[model samples]
Target: MFEVLPHLAPDPILGLSAAYREDTNPNKIDLGVGVYKDEQGNTPILSSVAKAQKMLLETETSKTYITPQGNQGFIDGMLSLLLGKSSPVLLSDRVAAVQAPGGCGALRILSELLVRCNDNAKVWVSDPTWANHIPLIGSAGLKIEKYPYFDKATASIRFDAMMETLRQVEKGDVVLLHGCCHNPTGADLTNAQWDEVLEVAKEREFLPFIDVAYLGFGEGLDEDAYGLRLLIENLPEVIVAASCSKNFGLYRERVGLAAIITEDSKTRNIAQAQIQSIARGIYSMPPSYGGALVDIILADEALNNEWVSEVNDMRERMKTLRAMLVKNLHENGSPKDFSFVNDQKGMFSFLCITPEQVREVREKHSVYFVDSSRVNIAGINQQNVETLAKALVSVL
Candidate 1:
């Protein structure tokens, strides 16, 4: 029976990480994975998260099994953070939330929910989305299609092409959008662009399913959530999958929320139950410690403020790195203009290099990035910025 299992290919990013670890090159640089790293190349836990954990240790006593939906406090806090407390979605009793393992888990459960609602529900994803999205959504038995998003020629969002494709969306189809800090390509839609998408969505009658994994990593807390908030405000139905991994630095803790907004309170209650049932069938319950930490931090005004500031600092640092890289590339005598790096927000940017160039960078220069030439801006530092820039030029 075991022999019937097929051999699986190693994950591209993780395989690159392993290769980097084995290389003895002194000047090797890794820009593959999407995790945040400090100037010293460390993924440090946030101070706010530490403080919240201490408080939980001192006061919290119950470790018993939580409900299928997990902690109500965690869900409520996440909902408030994603959509303001007084937003129409919340005020009208048309929204509900449930704690999930992480954004991936939330997305998976949401896929299940969509399939449950309508077995033939079709989901439209952006081209060049996160690599894992293919398997995650497909595994849930939903049909997946692509829409034009990033343009290699311009190194920016293909808004015109995107609108053209979305305009043809069949009614009742689901359109998956990146809430902020679009993975693999940091190009985000401006408010005016978002307005246009919303109009198209309204006209097409498709539901918006937003994955807000990098809420505070783009511009700011509320600022990064602009598209999502706008959707909930103007639309009667929406689905959101939010993660605390990047913003709260709780990657391993697996804390996230899955929220749904319906047209009425009765539908909200029914949807909430369906979500809970889906989660029960999947993982039964999400982890408790991370949820407790987030609940404590979000409940306290002081801690919440500090966390927001820390998130802002991280965001600013990535922006600075983007600028520094562009400068470094220019100083290194590159023939092509690479200023688009600065225009992109969040932790990633695509170099738009061919796979052969990517291999050259890795094999000859000891520099590692994905096959798609996507680099993590957070992985760059003042110490190695010039080196990375020079390596990129060498490959060119």
Candidate 2:
């Protein structure tokens, strides 16, 4: 059995990270991982989280397992955070939510739910979605299909083509959508475009399974959730996978939520039971520390406001970095136009460079980004923007 096991290639992103760490170059840059860093190249813990942790330490009593659905405060807070307080869907008695280990866990649990609902369940994903989505959902024995999303020529969303393809989805099929700050490409749908997609989902009679890992990264919290809320308002059913890793800076804590909306209260209760049962079969129970921290933060008005402020600051920093990179590229006289970089939201943007160029930049210029030319915008700063721009110009 041991001899029959085959060797596997290292993950591309992790492989690049290892290579970057081994290189002794003084000026080496790393933009391969999809993590948010500050100007000092640190993933700082939010002040809100710190305060909440202190509070939990002082008052918390039990270390035993919470419910299979996890903390009620956390689940309620997440629903309000994602769908807003006044959302009509909340009052309709059609929604249910449960905590997962993280966004990936949420997605996997939802995939199991889909299979339980229909044996031949299929989910449509974007062409250039997060790399892990394929494995996380597919490994659970769900059929996967791709719809045209990113247009490489312009490095933007291929909205028309995407809509046309989605139109072909059969009734009751599941469609996976990025709620905000689309990963890998960072190109998000406008409100108008979201309206179009909503229309298509309605007409096609398919359910929307939204992945919202970077909710507050695109814009404000409310602004980023506009499309998702719009869908919840109009449609009778939808699925949401939300993560606290990026926004709350709780990456290591593995905090996430899986929310589902159904046609009526009975269905909602049944769905909740199934989700809790599925989670029990997987991780048994989500870690209590992260959920407790999140619950405390959301329950306290002052801490919640501070968290919002911190999220806003991070969003603004990314925007500024985008502008700095674009300005540096233009001033450096690069042949390629990178103004689109500023338009893209979130922490990532694909450089649209050849694989050869990417390798050349990494090996020759001490610049490290993914082989696909995707860079983390947060990895750039005032000190290194010029150097990165020059390195990119050399490759071009």
Candidate 3:
């Protein structure tokens, strides 16, 4: 059986990281991994998180397993964060949430629940969604389909094409949407476009499964959640998988929440039990550290404010980096119009360069990123932006 197993290729993103680490070039720039990096090229822990960890260390009394739902404070805090405190869904008692290992874990658990609920349901994903989405959702015995999403040539969302395909979706199918900060492509739907998609969902009766990974990375917290909140308020049933990795800077802690909103309290209770059952069969229990950290930050008014401020700083830095990259590109004599990068929100954006160009830059200039040319904007800084621009220009 061991001999019969086939060798597998490493993940593209992780492979890129390995190659980057091995490169002897001192000026080599890494725009491959999705992790947030500060000006000093570090994924620093937020100060609020540090404070929370200190508090937890001093106060935590036991090492026993938490409930299947993980931390109740985390669940309540995250639900309130995702949906407004006064959201109708909350007021009506129609949402069920459970903790998961990470965003990946949340996605898998939610996908499993979808299969358990309706095995035949097809899940429609964006054409250029996060690479992990395919295996995470498809492995749960659901057929995966693609709808038009990003247009690499234009470096923008293919809204009309996306709407056209979604309109054809059958009733009871699941449509996976990036809540904000779309992965790989970085392009996202406008509010008007979201409304259009909502109308289509209403007409077709398809279930909406939202992936909220970069909650505060794109825009303000509430602003980033606009489309997701709209669906929850309007639709009778919705699914959400949220992460604390980006927002709380707890990547290794693997904190995430999988939530489902039903029509009423009765259905919500039933769905909650089903989700907990699915979690028990998969991971048995979720980790407590990350969730506890998030709970601490959100529960304390002073710490919550501090966390929000830190998130705002990160967001502004990325925005500044995007602008600087475009400026440097222009200065480097590349005739390409990369102005779209400034308009796109989040840490990622496709450079819209060909695969050959991507390879040439990597080989000749030691500028590392995935073959798709999706770069982590946070990787750009005052020090290496010019080098990156020069590399890109040389390839072009």
Using all chains and alpha carbons, the TM-scores for the candidates as numbered come to 0.98, 0.98, 0.99
Give the clash count for model 2. 0
In candidate 3, residue 329 scores what lDDT?
97
Reference-based TM-score, model 3: 0.99
Candidate 2 lDDT by residue in tens digits, 1-396: 799999998888778889999999988888988788998899998999999999999999988879889999999899989999888888888998899999988999999999899868789999988888898999889999999999878988999899999999999799999999988888999999999989999999999999999988998999999999999999889999999999999999999999999989999999999999999888878898898999999889999999999999999999999999999999999999999998899989988888899999999988998887889999998888999999999989
Model 1 TM-score?
0.98
* Ranking of all candidate structures by their lDDT, best first: 3, 2, 1
Q: Pick the candidate with the highest TM-score.
A: 3
Model 3 misplacement above 4 A: none
- Which tens-of-lDDT digit does each residue in 198-280 have in candidate 3? 89999999999999999998988999999999999999999999999998899999999999999889989999999899988
Runs in model 1 lying further than 4 Å from the true structure? none
Model 3 scores worst on lDDT over the 10 consecutive residues at 84-93
Superposition error at 181 for model 3 (Å): 0.7
